[model samples]
Target chain A: MVIMRRVAAGLLVMLLSMMARAELVVEVTQGVEAPTAIAVVPFGNETGSALSEDVAAIVQQDLQRSGFFQPMARENMLGFPVQQSELYYRDWRIAKMDYVVIGRAVSVGANDISVRFELYDVLREQSLLSEQVTITRDNLRDGAHFIADRLFERLTGLQGAFSTRIVYVTAEQLAPGKQRFRLQLADWDGARARTILESSEPIMSPVWSMDGSKLAYVSFETGKPAIYVQYLATGRRERIQSFPGLNGAPAWSPDGSQLALVLSRDGNPEIYILDLQSRQLQRVTRHYGIDTEPSWAPDGQSLIFTSDRGGQPQIYRLELANRKLERLTFEGNYNSSGRLTQDGRFLAMVHRSGGGGNGFDVAVQDLKTGRLDVLTRSGMVESPSIAPNGSVVIYATQEGTRGVLAAVSLDGRVQFRMPAVSGDVREPAWSPYLR
Target chain B: MEIRSYIVPFVLALGVHAAVLALLSTHWMGHDEPQRKVPRHIEAQMIDLTALARREAEQAHIAEERAREAEQAQQAERKRQERVAAEQRRQELAKQQAEAETKRKARQEAEKKRQKEQAAQRAAEQKRQAELEAKRKAEAVERKRKAEEQARRQEAEVKRKAEAAAKAAKERERKQAQAEAELKQALAREQKAREAAARQASQAVIGDIQSYIQAMLQNGWRIPSTARNGMEAVVTIHLLPNGEVDQAYIHTSSGNAAFDNSAIQAVYRVQRFPRVADIDPILFERRLRKLSVKFRPEGLRW
Candidate 1:
């Protein structure tokens, strides 16, 4: 009877094996047109030590969070090969995996470790990367992020901002009407969060420098809004401007030599470029109406800023070579906070789609083709920051009463949210590609 | 040279002789009376000495003339007789030639009869040969027709047998296919019956979970004023096995924020879905862990 039961169990397993041939792929259809299929095997640990983090899992999550890859679940992986020779290309191919990554961690010292990984093209039967790196025990997550960034760049032919960071403002309620506002910086995937500034006032309009080493933002810490630049590696910061009325929306030039900020010291809130070395001011916009939120073009030859010169809050481009101003957005009644892409071909902003400028959502406009795409359908969204590659845009949106950070692809295909663990988060600022 | 020269002279002499004879005859007639008178006068003049002699000579001449006359008359009579005999001989010869001609015509008639008989015999022989040849050809043709008919019938019989074999084979194939189809149908019916039993057993557990959750959410949901009946919002809900809601967010919007907020609120307000605990664990994991619920105010009425 026992043998018969064993035979029956074996038959059942065979049937299950046949059924397993039909894989269940969780397709993030809101992602890009075609997402790459990848498998990140559980890393082989040879150190005889209990690690705190799963490096391979972190890499997998990072790739998936980018909305460019559909990482296979760890349960579906067949083998955990630590070396290239042990890898079976046919097995990964049968699982419909386009790429496979395997790694091993070896202890090098009391606290240091050497982590090595190999990325293989299952279809091409070739190794894309096989490298080793030395890092401390706590740096495995960062090492995984670096490996993911390298893989992304190699596969997409563009630099990956996965290893970069994002700065945003988070508000926590202390009492009925009291709150604590903090400027927090974290990895692009919302991991390893660290607060740089915490105050009772608000923080808005955080912008990254060209090299991604410094941040320029408007802080209300001094009882009035002031523009300040802070170095991230070192904890050094200085107040750049404290003009009266309005000194907000500070944007860094591409060469890091100047800042185009909103200043209402004259009559109306207009755009002004301040030479950082000489501290000299150059007025860029003069209109009876409000002109603010000056964003420098990637080439630093022109500035795209929000203005109501045409009787509505529209985006306008101002050429620095000559003082000729041209209106950019003419579709909606209220279009503001225009952020140009690295090529100056696309502009992402908060736009009021319809209804007398009441419903606000994130939108991206192609400058060359004169086409506009509304990225978010839900209104009441703001502060859209574009990635360095211009493939995605992250914006601040409200979910019920809590503010959350949501990202949408420039093509309006994908949408995901990075909800804070506690408190409300807003004003997302995507950093440039970091070395 | 010799015969032409003689013929020309002889013709000329004959012509001359004929002309002279004609003239002499005419002279003699004219002189008939004159010649009688002159002979008498000549007798008278010879009178004196030889009267007696002359008389005697005259008498002698007369006698001689008479004799010559008589001789000439006899000659004329002989010549007439000869001419008459010659005419009779010529008549006899003509009668003999006519008889010979009659005999020749009779011989020609006999030859013609013989040739006619020969031609008739030859025609009869030819007719006999033609009849024999016609009979032989008919026999040969009749024999060929019999042979061909036999061949055609044999070929038809072979073709009929082939058709019969083909029909039998096709019938067998159709029967085999029908039997297979009936067997497949029986198997399918048996499988379907078993599946129906199993599904009926689990129907309450699986069906009640989704419906119960949906009902609870709908009861708590408030359709916003900005929402139309046809607008829908899809929200993805993540849950743990203990019926605790891990996360709930909107996957697709209805283009109206107030309507979307209401739908999101409904999912969150129904904090737990306890019906999932009654279902199989595998079923819950597969179907309910990450469930997407579409909230359309129009769907509630239907």
Candidate 2:
């Protein structure tokens, strides 16, 4: 029952997300300054390696609640060095602090972690951005929001949405308090909430880091449920093969090295791509049965999931180097999570078939022609986030049982909410636009 | 050269000192008999005849017409000597009547001389003489003495030459008509006494020129009353000789600069006038020397 963490890559995993030999000195242009200031520190795991969360403090409260930064607070740090020679540079230019993020988390083995970060320019004392990301404390909050979206695009020249990935849900105490169902691994704003696996039994699909840093979840911890890779700074973890019947969906690989998951391991659920420099998990899908949500394609050469092999749940596009699969959504019978658009051109999903109470809204299809754009007006809208200049949208629904963390502007004018201090704030993850 | 040169001789010792210049020149050094008693009363001011009584009455009427022409030339020399003696007594009576008429006719013709010596001759003859002789006696007495002898010799030569030429012509015609009527009544009484002495010398030369112009016009002539005639002025008076007016000249003008300034303010309001008899000394230059004043106001006229 997990939904939404959809990323469908195609142009060959967007040319293997670089390192055709490695050095491509970046140049993606266009206007950048929307709400975008990012400072994210605290990744130094050293080796104790139990990163439940804190990937640079969940990418600095996800780029400071995305209202664009005035963020230098961490108790007013002028120079917080974890490496790069513990930089000084006039104490961040006497604390004016334009950019000075730092990162560490070393112990690269048993629970795997090699996260190195540097992002300076405290008034030009050099080093605009450096990176070394290898995460396993189940993907150190997706490698600390993927080096905070590449040091928020190298000190704000823009596009470092602190590497996107935030899938929240935290109902932390079962007795002392009341919430017993939570789902949260925050990095896009709700800071370092690192419970990659807690539940009164329920969790959902949270997939990211094809350069966003990391996530991929759907956890009932492991009862009749499975699928996980949790490290957001250093609380280590991983579990990508729970089988017996329909494992769940998990997407990544625009090159955080690969993972487009949803697996019954093989008899029924489909889609897979787990490379990690060749830990090699390939099986694109042979569909002898219903397929589940599997997204990628920011150019990981094709993959868009949720398939009932054409009978009900639709939306499919496979082509990961000729494992050619097609049927990409037809009208709607019950479309599920389909997040594509970082300009692969539109997909935001979850438009269930309307009939009874005209339920589940939030739509938007347009991958060049299959137009939809439904956007919500009343109730159950969920998990949306497409800002970083894709023009606003942040989501989590249920206004009545009150899980509230809404935001919408993708042309439905503007709706809002960031609510929750008490109870029902459910699974809401909207990350991407940072740097 | 110092000390005031000794005070300049003590101030010249109180003014030159020559005994005060001999006590002011000769005061009484030679007084002489009261200076001959005041020049003898100024020599009695010699011009006496009561100050020439009309120039001695015109020199006594020109010396009485030169003594009446020397008394008519002595009555014409006494009638020219009585006509030369009656012409010498008529020449002596014609020399006695011419001798007695040539002797009385030679005595009557020698008496009828012989009277009739002849008468007779005739009768001579006859006389018869005697007879008639008597008749004739009468014829005879003859011529009677030849008429008494020629009347006695013509009456003695006519009575002696008519009584001596009638008494010398009757004295020469009574003295020549009494000397021609006494020389025409003495030339009509000397032409009526020379017209009464030129009518009393022109009435005594008009009564001494009208009492010396009424005693120099008795000098009371004033005429001020703010003097108006044709209002002339020109004043400048300056006088003193007692007719005072020390300074006057208000310059009255008639070229009418305000009626010659009111006739120079009426000759300075008639400073002093009253004295012009013999006019004191022509009154300091004939009085009112500068008075060209003309404001008549009808005062003094001719």
Candidate 3:
């Protein structure tokens, strides 16, 4: 055990040394304290055909949803300027808009349109971006999203995640005794949803790999819980883990070289680290008390899992090489489902309040300070997933018995809910930064 | 009265006798021959002598008596003339003697009056000299008395003044010592109070400077949306004495670009902090010149 611990220390030293120097990550929950003002004027239709989608409105919504921009409402716009000659910068300045976007959508053919947009820096009174792209009628939304992404990146000096996708599981009650579960993938705004799988069995714990091209989850289809990895683009899937007692809680390692999972094959639930290349399983926990729900740390040097060894289920960190386990959480009696943030600075988990409530709520804790914060007052919350920027956390919550996905910024200041779909949605998995 | 009666009788007798002599001389000369008449009368006289003697005795006696009377009268007249001459001489002598006596008495009285005036003058001179001597003696005594009195008074005054001077010196020395002691104590107390006041004043200045900086930053900061409720950015800012921002950069970012930029922008917006410039240079350099402020947008939570 001592030699193994030494190896683990060496591994940690090597891994930490190889990693880039991490900047201090301060959790910000409050949306932009001063959201930048922007004006998205409706584009002039020179083609004279009735436009199906309001491209400017779509772009305005995209920027507004990011919480970093405050888009002026259409009624608030003083003038609609499509051409450079008609752009009265003083009008936008009077409207308190820092930037303005104007464009004209010209229908080139029956199926194609030429969309040209010019972004104006109203404060500086200069054109920031001018671009023209051809698209079909259905591609107008996509084109608008592209414009919003460009504007966001230019103004905030950070890459825009507006064009990203999110996959979630939804369950619909069909008959008196039957329920249908669908694994759905959709745009960031829940638009353009496409189902990848549908089954009557329950689906739980859907997680995306680091590349955002594959998803791993557990399904109760074979009369037992099994972990399956599915290729998102090809609809190809394979059952990766199916043990004697329990096979669930699949988490991908940072490099996609391994998966940390919980297995009960040895008569008790324990965490196991499976090497993806060698198909080798390594037991990471030896506690007789139940150990489950293993998640990989960002550096992949360790894994955090839930265990009931000391008493109630609490989170523990296990160094992979030496199998050294350390208790990470002591704030509450029941702290489980630990999910590490992208920066490895915080852990979002299912925490039960000390007042002995019947349900658990989403909570986050600073790993360095041992400070815990209960983020949600509403009970019965679970599946907390951090966004790619580590600024927000999306979780599955119940609102009057209807499961809905809600997102809260890490500091718990900004909270919003996704539009309700056709059925109850849960287990939301935010995609990584897209290429 | 006898002298006046004699003067008239003598004048008459002389006149009669002169007349008789003239007549007799005239008659004799005229009658040179009458010389012979006397012889004739002589013869008658003898006859009558007896008759005359008898008559004379009566007459003679008368004559005799007459003769005797005549003889007696002649003798009486001679006696009277002698008496008169003698009386004249005696009267002359008596008059001369009386004149001489009166002259002598007058001279004697004049001499006496002169002698009395001389004596009186001599007595007045003596009295005046004596009075002068007495007055000189009295003046000497008075001068001596006054001198003695003045000397006594001077001695007493000198002794009294010496004692008063000694007492005054002692009192002045004691007062001077007390005053020096009080002044020393007062100086010490004043020094202590001054030090305490300086300390309190400097502390107040420090507080004011801090409050000014905080207020300026509050007005200057525009917290970005990326700043969370608890997000903090520690920015080190360098400033000039005139309250101008010389340099401001993040010592530690809150890992949010917008948040860090917002903090930096706040520092830039203030441009200068005149409050810090108002503080003491030494204290400012020690505590406030290069200050690091932690900005937390705690109120920004929705």
Strongest candidate by DockQ: 3
How do the residues A1-435 of candidate 2 rate in per-residue lDDT, one tens digit apiece?
012111222222223322222211111111112232234556567887467766777667545544434357777775567876877766765665445678777787787878777776543356766778786776666676666566544433346555544566655455764446665655454544555556676677665564444566777745577777766556466776565776676777665777777777566677777776766887778868677677776766788877776667777788877777777677757777666766677777777765666667677676766667676765587666565444345677776766666665454434556545456666566655434
- Model 1: per-residue Cα lDDT over B1-302, one tens digit each: 34336656756975896689669757755644463334321111111435444664675576556657776776665456445544644564455455445555555555565566545645654554564466456645654664465455445545655566677777887888788788657745764564455446545555667567777776546553334446777888787887767777788887766456556656655567776666666556555677777877752211
**Candidate 3 total steric clashes:** 30
Which candidate, 2 or 3, would have the higher DockQ against the true structure?
3
Candidate 3 global lDDT: 0.75
Screening candidate 1 with a backbone cut-off below 3 angstroms (N, C-alpha, C), the clashing residue pairs are: none
lDDT of 2: 0.54
Better of 1 and 3 by DockQ: 3
In model 3, which regions exceed 4 Å deviation?
A1-38, A43-51, A82-136, B1-220, B228-256, B260-302
How should the candidates be ordered by TM-score, best one leading? 3, 1, 2
The better-scoring model by lDDT among 1 and 2 is 1
Q: Per-residue CA lDDT of candidate 3, range B125-167, in tens?
A: 5665565466556656665665565555555555656666777
Off by over 4 Å in 2: A1-156, A162-165, A168-179, A185-189, A192-199, A208-244, A252-261, A265-297, A300-319, A324-430, B1-302
lDDT, candidate 2, B1-302, per-residue tens: 34336445644742454345346423432343253344321111222435344654665466445545654774444234223322322342233233334334544454444444435543553553453454346435544554565455445434544544564566666676677567545544553464356335533533443343223312322222122234444445454555445554444444433233323323333334444222424222322333333333332110
Q: What is the TM-score of chain A in candidate 3?
A: 0.83
List residue ranges in candidate 1 displaced over 4 A: A1-32, A355-358, B1-302
